[model samples]
Target: MALEYDLVIIGATAAARVAAIEAVNLQARVALILPHPANGQVHPQSDFYPYALAQIAKTIQTNRGQIQSPSSYPWKYAYTAIDRLEQESSPALLAAMGVDTIFGTGEFCRRPHLAFNINQRYLRARAYLIATGSVSDYPIIPGIQSAGYLTLDRLPSLVEREIPLRWAIIGAESIGVELAQTLAKLGCQVKLIVETEQILPYEDLDFANLIQAQLEADGVRVYLATIVTKVSQENRSKLVVMGDESIDVDEIFIALPDRPFIEPFNLAGVGIDHTDKGISIDNKLRTSHPQIYACGNVCGNVLGGYHSQSLTQYEAKIVVHNALNWRKIKVDYSSYDRLPWAVYTDPPLARVGMTIGAATNSPRRDLIILQKYLKTCPQAILNNITSGFCQIVVTRTGQILGAEIVGQNAPELIQILALAIQQKLKITDLTTFPCLSPSYTEFIYQAAQEWHTYNRNQKQQRQNGWLNCLCWWK
Candidate 1:
């Protein structure tokens, strides 16, 4: 039988799943095509799965003198979540929502026809959403290929074996930081290398300083402004040579950046525009070909930033609405700027809108900047974690530009700033809003007061200069 769907979504990541659900809700027949073996944290080649399994095995072994088999862990967790959901809701919930799941790789057979190799059978679909996410990308470093290092997708499994006591991680992005911390917690001597002058270069300098301090205190050796020239194996240990420096480690885990996994599917034939970054898409999430849409890692919108799964789902919602209701509505992503995000390291750093540097360098150079120290906040004193502060940027007319927090629960605290920015709320609006006493959020009120005071001083200075000019003219 020829299978046809009003909307077809490729990949099963957060964005793809949300697109499928939203399309179905719009009364469109939806077909979701996933990889033969899902490749993500939730399913197949995820690095975190093995660590989670090992934790479960340890728990079971402690309770019952025998350890649970490692291979059964993924299935065990999958069934547990599915069973719990089914028991709490209806078994046919997914199907009833009009989303049909097809397990296979989806490739373009024609302009509007998508061929899916599902369990060794062929299937086709209509409109398609390319949300294939991404895979780890390895750069062409000298001798590194022959050294056999593991990508972020494969590192979790290697960590589960727990064989490598001495480990070297190349790259200090979010994944590198997480792996370095996780392996250190599991008793591995971790050494992290980054080509940049500082770790988390995309983040604010203050946040990076806090994270670097924490990692060093944890006994993790971080080499910054260094590049890995080559990697080779010697005596069953990985020898990584960075410039003139050589380090021997049991395993070399590459937390290096990833590019979109688009080559295998041969997307060029389908007329999709792509670069080293990934597929190109406009604000509306529409690719060069109007009928085809892209989201998530496959698109370069968020790049290396920690875009929450929730935000990707939101982007997918925009894609679905554009695909289904193109006549009645047009998707706009300008308002999507300044989304809040964070690094999950201890003493987490969260930011929204623009940074002081970003604002100064931006075309909006007329912005007013105000910062309040965490030491001034009551909660920071009580918690003994006065390492960071709250910074807010506003315009002369009191319009909020951006906010950043770099202390405990900074991610949670940044939520209010995100909401304020989204609503285009003025700084004055926050002064009257009731806030809890003795909390980190009180810093917002303090920062607002500082901004007002600075604004008044600037106005008085301007008035005095004008009066002096009038006296000279008289």
Candidate 2:
């Protein structure tokens, strides 16, 4: 006999689990299908490993200056800590929460009716969500496969082993850049190769430049606008050839873009629309089939470039509400623009909405570009960490359009602006909001003060012009 469900979430991704949990909370029967499971259970992977390592390495760099060896910090303990944090999303935990956690691969069928077939059982649901997540996309380079390289997914295995003395990171993605800085701070020589003119192609140039400078300051050799022509093994070292110039390193890491995992689901036979990037979805996040929906990395460009876990979880909530309720709630990221996302770098980089360039070209003619440096903040000055700033784009009347932040607790600080933009709050509101003393958030207050001062000056100039006209009439 075939089983039925309110929703069948395909894949064992974090997004999949979120959708299942959310559906259950809405009083819906949910079946979560895990594509590949060991012993009928799936263990979730931790995305916090790189962030944890980066923080630990930054602390070491601050206290001990240049590390002479990678063993200066306890790398194994960091991995163990991350492992300990994984039980919260375990299959057993989900099952305990009333989710039907099925373990195996599945394919969509369309013969009699749309159904998912796995392990000789058929799953028919009112709606289906594909959240298989993404995998690394390798660039075409000669001898790369034969040379053997590590992707971000395989990087955690090296924590148990000795850190390589030297590394050649092939791409400049956020994860790749984070690991480069971490490895460099841990006393490894890192060579970062970028194919574009800048490191992060999607971010503002100033933001990307700040991170690149920090990477170089941490002793990472950056090669901008460069590509790896080929890769070969030379004795015990790997040779990364870039045109006539070549460098030999102990190991090579590939950090290309990620493509969605959708081939196994047999979407073509089921008449679902998809591409090399990911499945196509409307504003409601519905697939070609109205009964089907997708989210997370599987949705590809749905969230633009902010593909963080938090945003995916947000998408999961939208999918759940729309799947269970009669009235569908559209997936609107923060009301006006994209939600904020951060890169776990030394000083960190957090961004949301329009860049300065985008804001300048906006329909709003009266735009206020408020900027303040962290060097001016007491907390940053006291801590001797003052190499970042906050820049916000707003209308003359105080409507915030976008913001870019790079400084201490930047990721945390940017959220304030994100909420402000979402609620359509004015710049004056930020100026009046009470902040704890000696906090990084004071930078935001200072930037908001600029708008206040500008507004006062404009009012004064208009009053003066009116008085001059009165004198002329008299």
Candidate 3:
């Protein structure tokens, strides 16, 4: 006999599991399919490896004057941590949570009413969700595949062997940037090549430059606005060619854009609109077939930002509600303004909402830019770690439009701003918000304070001192 479910999630990713749990909590029968063993089923917390490695690298960097050699602590501990985390989300645990877990590759069948056929079992559901994640999209450079290279997923293999002495990373996405700095800090020679003019093309130019300078200071050779024409094996080393110039390195790492893993599901059988990017969906996270939906990396450009686990979790909630309930709830990433993202570099770079460049190019001309440097913060001075700044964009009337933070605890700091943006809070709210003395959060308060001065100046410029006093008194 075949099984039936209210929701059939067609992937084993973290987002799939999240939706399954939510569906079960909402009193719906849920089944989660573990697609092909090799599909990109990454644990949501896999990002912990890079973040932990960055911390180890920072410690080594701080004591470089006395330390003769950095230890292998990062590799030794980071991989083990990820292994332990993966066990917690194993299929068995998911099954225990009332998610009828099925392990096998599957495809949609239109016959005898819509169902997913897996190992001769017909799993029928009222609605289906495609949460299959994405895999690294290697560029089509000549001879590169033959020469061989590593992607972000393959970096864990480095633990089994020695770190490459010389490395050429072919992209400047967040992973590439984070690893370049971590590797250089560990005493490896790294060359980062970016086809775009800036390291992080989507971020503000000045913020990108700040991270670039930090990478260079850490001994990374940065190549901007350059394209790799070819890659070839030269004796024991690999040569990456860019027009007339070439770089010789012991290994190459490709960090290009990701291609969604949507092939196996046979999306066409059910008429789900999709492209090379991923499945297309309405704001409510519904596919062309009202009975089906898509979320996470599988949604591709339909969503913004890198593959953020937080954003994926948010999408999962909306998917569960819309799939199980008739009263549909639409997803609004708030134009990606309410969703915060971060790159875990040494000091870290975090942003939410519009950047300075984005705001300037936007049609809104009433926006004001305010900046506060870390050097001026007493906490930063006390900790002897002053290296970055916080910049905020707001309206002339003090409403916060967005924020860019590059400094200690940036990821944690951005969340506060993200919440503020989500609530439509003004700069005055942030400035007046109580904060601990001598803390990194003071950076936000200081930046928000500039709005007060700017407002005062505007008021004075419009009228005499006596008029300004009268206005204030009223």
Candidate closest to the true structure, highest TM-score: 3
* Residue 64 shift from truth in candidate 1, angstroms: 31
Scanning candidate 3 in windows of ten residues, the lowest lDDT window is 61-70
Query: Candidate 3: lDDT of 441?
Result: 86
* Error in Å for residue 301 of model 2: 2.4
Candidate 1 residue pairs that clash: none
Q: Which stretches of candidate 2 lie over 4 Å from their true place?
A: 37-45, 61-69, 72-74, 302-304, 333-338, 361-363, 456-474
Ranking by TM-score: 3, 2, 1
lDDT of 2 by residue, 1-474 (tens): 599999999977788888988898888999999886321222346467777777777566432355444773546766776777767777788899888989878799987889999899899999999888877666689998888888766667787677788899988678888889888877888899999999877788888998999999888899999988989889988899998899999888887877787877889997789989899988888889888899988878544354677778888899988877679988775543648878888888887777876876677678878888889998898899869998899887788888989988999999999999888898889999898779888888988998877878889999999999999999
lDDT of 3 by residue, 1-474 (tens): 478989999876788888988898898998999886363344555667776677777666534344233456678777887778777887888888888888888899888888999989998989999998777776899999889998766777778876677889988678889989988888778899999999988778888899999999888899999999999999999999999999898999888888888888778998999999889999999999989999999888422347788788899999999998899988876656788888888778998888878778888779898888988888899999868999888988788888999989999999999999989999899988898979988878888888888888878787887787898999
Model 1, 1-474: lDDT tens per residue? 457667778774656776777887788898777764244332322433433433343333221223222243433553454445434323145566767877656566553454544455445544578887777776678887787777656644543453566788888667687567545544457799998888888877766877888877665789999998888879778899998999998888877766776665557767879987889987777788767788877775562365355567777888888777645244455555557877666666777777766876778657887887777787878888667777888888888878878777788888888888989999888876687878877867776778668978988999999999999999
Question: What's model 1's TM-score?
Answer: 0.81
Pick by lDDT: which candidate is best? 3
| Per-residue lDDT of 362 in model 3 | 85
Clashes of each: 0, 0, 0
TM-score of each model, paired residue for residue = 0.81, 0.91, 0.92
List the candidates ranked by lDDT, beginning with the highest. Answer: 3, 2, 1
